[model samples]
Target chain A: MAFRLIHASDLHLGRRFANIPQPPDGNIRGRLMEARHASISRIAKVAHDRNAKHILLAGDTFDTATPSDSVVRQALTAMGENADIHWWLLPGNHDNLKDAEPLWETITRDAPANVHALADASAVELAPKIFLFPCPVAFRSSGRDLTANLMDIPATKGALRIGLAHGGVVDLPTAVLTFRPTETVAPGSIILRLATGTDVSKSAIAHIIAAAPNRIGSSMDGAVSA
Target chain B: MTLEGPGAPPTVEEVETGAFLWINTELPLLPNTDCARALEAVLPDEGRRDILIRVRATGWASLQQQADLRQAAARLGPDFAHFDFDTNMLGTTYDDADLDDIDKAGALRLAANRLKEGTESETLSAEERAVSAGALARLYAYVKEAAE
Candidate 1:
């Protein structure tokens, strides 16, 4: 047995304050501005403490696509701790908020290997044991969803074959799946739902696809029935 | 070890002329950093040192304050550099509408310019330097003051 992967989603990093218009310079709206980093650090620490081999951050590391210096620094410091566990982060729509925000741009350019940002569909040999096939959300809002694209990869051979794409099957137009779902899924492959929480609408679309209910009222409570 | 030089310290009173600046950092960091503790004792590290000394007009010193703070930091020497929190975006928040293209471009420009100007004075032109410093002080004077 390798290491169990702790899959979490929708960490609205820098959204504690209202928006970019207010503290364009910087401010911790309430305690939450700092809490985002605190959340990430605790997550990293838990991942390591649990001996989790892999960490999947589906999207929206920063609350808005355009993050501030404080938010970026906080995330960096938090995520930097768990060098042992391989952390794979995808840029969802919020992270796609790059135009006005320079913070994410710098982060994309400067992230370490453990914190790999998936902008396109690719394959990662995660650790000594696992392999991850993922479709990273490059832009904020893509014309199509990521699940449809990743499921079309030609090869589907790995020990713990996993998929870390942005959306589920319901979100995308059926005409563009490239091939069929058989190209990616198996009984053993785990689908990690990493959604960027910019709005409820976008997440709802994602929720329907994976059949995981991560977007809309997605709770472990009734999630199995959902 | 003869530490004192010619103009180093004529007397104890003269050495006291050198000032120390304490800047408070509004960061949720785990405390117990000794150097910052000493500086924060007298002066507060409220937030961005660059924005504080350069931009915000507080009761004490203004951008005009840079001249004096720089001098003080110089006298204080390497000990001050220790308190320097490398805060590019120490604390930030975003909203819904910044999702627009135009808004993003403007925000990026502001951050990029701040980065380029804050760390690189010599590389920037006189016009660029003036813009970054928000004053007409020569690059030489700005750097010398900051180096202090």
Candidate 2:
């Protein structure tokens, strides 16, 4: 069965939008913070509207492993709000599974019944003929290619397989948005990690849905394949 | 003064207390671009100054672009005595100054003063300080270039 999925990654839900130049009265920080929640809301709306059975969050759902309690609460609430959509959130480099009590753990503890935090690399059946493989980012930078194991998993008969992952690769038939929080500063020079692109301002999940059919979706320079 | 735009390079101004620059555009600070050249032309290589760059852009600059700006700033280190920029993002604005009497070089000199009160500030978190310092360096380079 051909399944529709909303693939997004690198939500960076609690990132500090620091040192940005804006009008003194403009609510850039608040707007940015709200934007994160809006991305989730948008995902829920689109998932419901598109009749998508699953929402695949490849990785980096939270900006840090130890996100504030409020952020955790808000994220879970958003997931709970969309109870009909199944959410598969994979841990990324930013929210890696190395920590004993990482953000994923907190999420799993607090998430709604519809949400599943994928901390291990594994495969599961989404529907009768739909199989899913989640490649969890175990560390910030790992020597192992997270998605390599997907090929070894024997396919179930008549199943359509989908793979989800985060990070960069040279050749992929997907559009990638890499968010580098820091840049290497040359001697006597400096650099700031400024917010740019639709990834932060708008819902890349929506962008993927709008650009679907011919496009593969990814975030933070990672790729998701159907 | 607040510089609003469809994304242009920053401009320079001298205030009564010190000098400053304002970026009112929305273009990414990509290297070898007009915005880069505009920044280069507005900053000056001169005496002690306390410059606050009020960046009001909403553009997302790529890592490569930021790295290129860093490279340019490294080339013009000695020309500047000091540098600083606002630590707040979005919702902070820079007041405009009447710089009619001041020449371009004079304005840059005043802007490129000692880098902040000190290298490290107690008000800023370590990450903020580092980010602020690097942004200041990029701003200073543009000021040096523009002021000259």
Candidate 3:
């Protein structure tokens, strides 16, 4: 039994794009704004096509801490449309826990059955024998590594542990780093660069392909950048 | 029995069987006689076992006010089930009902300053420090916007 999932990050829905100067003629700003919302549907379609039951969004699902109510509701509706796909939303620097208290509260209150907000640092069962350790961002930045305690968390015997987090990997300067989700990186592997302004919309999608009997082994399966 | 701090005091199963009085530490000083009288008046109510007395503070107190508050706490210690003198400085009494824009802004500025200082205060526990840090981050964008 393969445990396949889609890994995505930095969707930044409800971004106004004020920094980017709009061209006079084409409604580029409106289209760009629409693209962010459209990306959710696109990701859903990909999940359907790939037959992946779970979509692990690493972090920064929204552009700002406080997005418009419409953005939140519509996004939930979109995910709700796809009842079978489990959408795990993680808090990132852009939509951190501290600044986005009401935003999270709204999500917690209104999210569909399919949507799971990764709002705390705890181990969650992704599937039978598959567990995810989420490192939710409390503030915009911190001196200590958020994922440092991943190794210390205990999981069921012979369970495949995957770490889901959103942050910059030390010494990595690239905009996006790709990893084969099924293949095990060496123990204590760091993944993904922090997504910044403007580049967040164009963020890459990393597919996680977990085949049967592949024990993630001692350390969490490093996060995928999408 | 007297209790201190926020939230409901332990149930009768958790603590001794007696009337529980929960007091907020930031409350203004009241005369010990008045406090005793109030407690005594409540003792006749057979149905209710717990009393919640909240004395809200209008602003940060002066040194004299702090001393008075401590003295009052000490005087009232014998009446409480648990007398905690260590004040948890998390409560506020500011009512926003009648405040105009200027007053609201002023209050925000004061709160931001207090949170900034509280983040650095060694007296604060780790949990309090974390809360202060979160509050500071939440206020940063607004403060920056106001400055601009």
Predicted structure with the largest DockQ when compared to the true one? 2
lDDT against the true structure, per candidate, is 0.43, 0.48, 0.54
Which parts of model 1 are misplaced by more than 4 Å?
A19-28, A97-105, A156-159, A167-226, B1-148
Q: Which candidate should be chosen as best, given lDDT against the real structure?
A: 3
Query: DockQ for each of the predicted structures, in order?
Result: 0.01, 0.03, 0.01
Expressed as tens digits, the lDDT of each residue in A1-226 for candidate 3 is 4566666666777877564344465453465567567767877887787677887777878889999999999998988899999999989888999999898888888999999888997778777766777888999987667766654554344455667767545423222233221223422232222222122222221222211100112011221111
Q: A1-226 in candidate 1: lDDT tens per residue? A: 3345655555667665342122444342444345445667666665666666676776665667666777776677567666777667766666663442465456667766567665556677665425567666666667775665544444434344345655433433342232222323442233322332222222112121111221222331112210
lDDT of 2 at A130: 54
lDDT of 3 by residue, B56-78 (tens): 33334322233345455556543
lDDT of 3 at A113: 92
- Global local distance difference test of model 2: 0.48
| Candidates ranked, most accurate by TM-score first | 2, 3, 1
Residue-level lDDT of model 2, residues A54-158, one tens digit each, is 877767778788888898789888878867888988887778888525577777787899999888766666776555677787878887666655444553443
Question: What TM-score does model 2 achieve against the real structure?
Answer: 0.50
- CA shift at A163, candidate 1, in angstroms? 1.7
Candidates 2 and 3, the one with greater TM-score? 2
TM-score of each: 0.44, 0.50, 0.48
- Writing each residue's lDDT as its tens digit, candidate 2 over B65-89 gives 4434445545543333222221233
Off by over 4 Å in 2: A22-26, A171-226, B1-148
